[model samples]
Target: MSIKINTYITILMLSSAAFISPLITKGQSTSLDSSQPETVVQKKYGLDPSKPLAKRIGNTPPEIIQKFRDAGMSPTLHRLSKTDSLKVVRAFQMLPPLHQHILKEHLLGISFLDNMPNTALTATVNPEDQFPVFTITFRAEILKQDVSQWLTEKEMSYFTKDFPGFRIAIEAGKLDAILYVLLHEATHVVDGSLGILAMDQNKGTSGMAVNLKSFTRNIWVDRTSICPSYTDSLTSQSRFRGGGRLLPMELARQIYQSAAKGPFVSLYATSSWHEDLAEYLTVTHFTKRLKQPFRIIIHEGRKEIFIYEPMKSATVSSRISLMKYFYAKAGSSVLYERHVKPGGRGFNG
Candidate 1:
């Protein structure tokens, strides 16, 4: 079980049902009751109309999307209906090239091919089985301002208030948080794919040791020791509690505090990380690979405080020194490329 083989197996298994039509051979409608309040229906393998098989087992579809929308749910996050199996197939067909590539790659790495049936596959959970199909239902209306406010209180400010209907907080600029969540969830999926307790299996092993080492090194050396000047006492308390004995990076601590709030917490905080990482990566990719800089700012309005990088050379150098100090403490070397032609770039030393 290589990662590639696992992904292919998973894709093949999912494709059997996900790519098929919902209409049965008997020409009977397979649609579930749209009026049902519960968004998800995990039913046994049967032809029950109440728990339509088509919706629960395949890719998403337009009719299913309509049903969800009519029910005031976010279609982007709902499962397909039994009657609209074809829609699920088509939606898979509509997936963007990058998304499809990533999905296929991920599936191949998880050993999903072995469990796929020769005939059409139905969603089921056998007592002895691994690899369960997850139906993630997205309800946009429920994630309105109330949810957004909760995120704000947790100090996750990297979200957009513009999208009124349905916005995945992961999209707004929180790439770090999103990536962390993805990795964490994907770790679970890998365990299921391998039919082993992935975490427990690695306990006391070299792999676990490396992971712990990286975490410890990052916390003690690479991370900022001082709390962000803007961090409120409540947020500090939350971070201390959530992080336990681990020395959290300032940004990481802020994110952990925010994520402890609720479901939205993880999304909000992770998205912020995503953005930070993305920006850091982008800068590194285009310019020379360098350490990230840190700075502080004070806001006149509401007597609030914030932190950011300044466009001045002196300020940038100071931030860079802090980054270097942290990185060096973590037992990592900093490699700087020869300065390319500087064209009025404020901090291109």
Candidate 2:
């Protein structure tokens, strides 16, 4: 896949140029059971690794921040104001209960920094468990953006250089960027926790194994390569796929046209099956739940050249069946978005 991968302390982070940096403190939390012995119980409040993220928000430790800098990521840690921290709360609330449930069970906390190279990434909190605790870091700038701007900006980065007079616009609505990004990054957590992307081998589960064949089985033979039938010569070499050079804007029409016929929801979804699930679910949610139109408007000097709407394809609709797992509703709202009735089974959770 063209995207970067970093595996640190068992499992780390995944984003555009993904990194799994060591972004935790030296301290670890232990169970309250008297059966276990401990010397000193040191807690750093919001920074404590023992507590799964509750309400408090905090920054990464100074040393961990330096590690990210050394790895060529955001070098400056951004201290959050009270209003900024509330933004995170609002974003977390916007998530489907299932997404929040998965993160609360395994995620440690979220971090923020200025000038981040990626939208978001996950790091280890307690790496010893089969399911390690996670911490996700965000580009502090998300607080200043809306979903439309963030989605458009992130989508634009796939191409190498900009098109002189042409620009691609992702016409999603004006929701908060934190909600959009947090949804995408947290879905990775769901995939890592549940086996939605059964293709991933890094989720910390020790026993609750999922069915081997995933939603990606027919579409992707492996994490990176698409099935022969789905791979178009034009779209396969996308700059997002480790292609030798960045393609020009003129090529976008053909690339997206080829992708619309395929099962993927967006061009970036073609990066990896892991990304496929993330993009597919998030983009679909952006459209269906929020009732926003995910239109890729290519404008040439204020005149529209081409407009690509990804949802109209029959291929994407066929895959909507796979989405039942994400929407299965139950009293366990915290767990399943929707419940599968008899005769119909959802993602083999």
Per-residue lDDT of candidate 1, residues 1-349 (tens digit) = 1011011111111111222111101001111236422133223322223432223343333443443345444424333344233533443333223223222322211111112111111111221212132222222222222312322322222222333332222111222221222222232222222221112222321111121222212221111222243233433333222321222223443443433332211221222221222222222221233132222222233443343332223312222222221122221222111111111111000
lDDT of 2 at 151: 73
Full-model lDDT, candidate 1 = 0.24
| Highest lDDT against the true fold, candidate | 2
Query: How far does residue 28 in candidate 1 sit from its true spot (Å)?
Result: 38
Candidate 2 residue pairs in clash (backbone atoms < 3 Å) = 130-204, 327-337, 327-338, 328-337, 328-338, 328-339, 329-337, 329-338, 329-339
In the order shown, the candidates' Cα RMSDs to the true structure are 19.8, 7.2
TM-score of candidate 1 to 2 decimals: 0.27
- Candidate 2 Cα outliers beyond 4 Å, as residue runs: 1-54, 61-64, 72-74, 160-162, 199-214, 330-349
Models 1 onward score TM values of: 0.27, 0.76
- How far residue 310's Cα lies from its native spot in candidate 2, in Å, is 1.1
